[model samples]
Target chain A: MASKKDPRTPAQIKLAKQLGAAIAEARKKAGLSQDELAYRCGLHRAYMGFVEQGRYSITVATLVQVCSELDAKPSEILDEIGH
Target chain B: MASKKDPRTPAQIKLAKQLGAAIAEARKKAGLSQDELAYRCGLHRAYMGFVEQGRYSITVATLVQVCSELDAKPSEILDEIGH
Candidate 1:
């Protein structure tokens, strides 16, 4: 239910995009599709897509759940991204 | 405005605590008190304490903002914590 017009700053938006890409990369490496990952994380498929597109703000809990499903550490993906 | 009874999973809760500690450490290293850091991040001081206590769920934007103020990268703090 997040709108594109949400008030995230430019830096935050950049971080989101970078983080999203990293998650998507991890999911791919784990041989999982967006829908599959979403199902595993108990997140909606649409929400997963939105997350990958950086159109949504991800909470810490959601990030952990996604990483657990992908056999990835949140830091693995996060560290790969530039601050 | 978050409660200890938040519906986060145990894993999420652990991650939150680890993350909170890392942030608190960063703030200390920056020589900033919780109130000072919260003021810099435009967050309420009480909310900052909750975040430090892992009693609140942090969004990506908030994490980035906190990191920016602390001269810490999200990944730096996240990677230092055990998954």
Candidate 2:
């Protein structure tokens, strides 16, 4: 394995879950299946699931792609958590 | 690497750079050196540099931490990109 960073801290994971919840809400509103959204974003469906579960630290670019697909703004999602 | 994902696409990189630029601008306005910001975020100076250069896909938690240290809202930074 290559060099890896430390695991996400609990606080970080809590924030990530908030983000994931926002994304999930947006995706559901957009009526796209998680797999469909992942396909559109050129990501694996499993990866998308992990993102939704707050199990992964999604990149900014990926967030854009996901938000774009859902017609949701990243700011809107960030706003959900008062970020 | 273990089950690595693909490298960022050109479009993704462009978007990343834009995000990075906004963050850099905010960091500068906050009067914090890159190294100082990195220290506060518990990240390596080199990683922070890459983030500023749009070479890294920063996680949401890290972004929040960085923005918190800058006293800038993540919403404000995403607003810079119309995200």
Each candidate's DockQ score against the native complex?
Answer: 0.66, 0.68
For candidate 2, give the docking quality class from DockQ: medium
Q: Cα miss at A69, model 1 (Å)?
A: 1.5
What is candidate 1's CA lDDT for residue B75?
69
Poorest 10 consecutive residues by lDDT, candidate 1 chain B:
B1-10
lDDT by residue (B1-83, candidate 2, tens digit) is 58666487888878879989999999999999999999998899999999999988887778888999999998878878878
Number of the top candidate by DockQ? 2
DockQ-based class of model 1: medium
In candidate 2, residue A58 scores what lDDT? 78
Which model scores highest in lDDT?
2
lDDT of 2 at B20: 92
Per-candidate local distance difference test: 0.85, 0.87
Per-candidate TM equals 0.88, 0.88
DockQ of 1: 0.66
Clashing residue pairs found in predicted model 2: none
Model 1 pairs whose backbones collide: none
Q: Write the per-residue lDDT of candidate 1 for residues B1-83, one digit (tens) a residue.
A: 76447687787778788889889999999999999999999999999998999888898678878999999988667778865
TM-score of chain A of 1: 0.90
Evaluate chain B of model 2: give its TM-score. 0.88
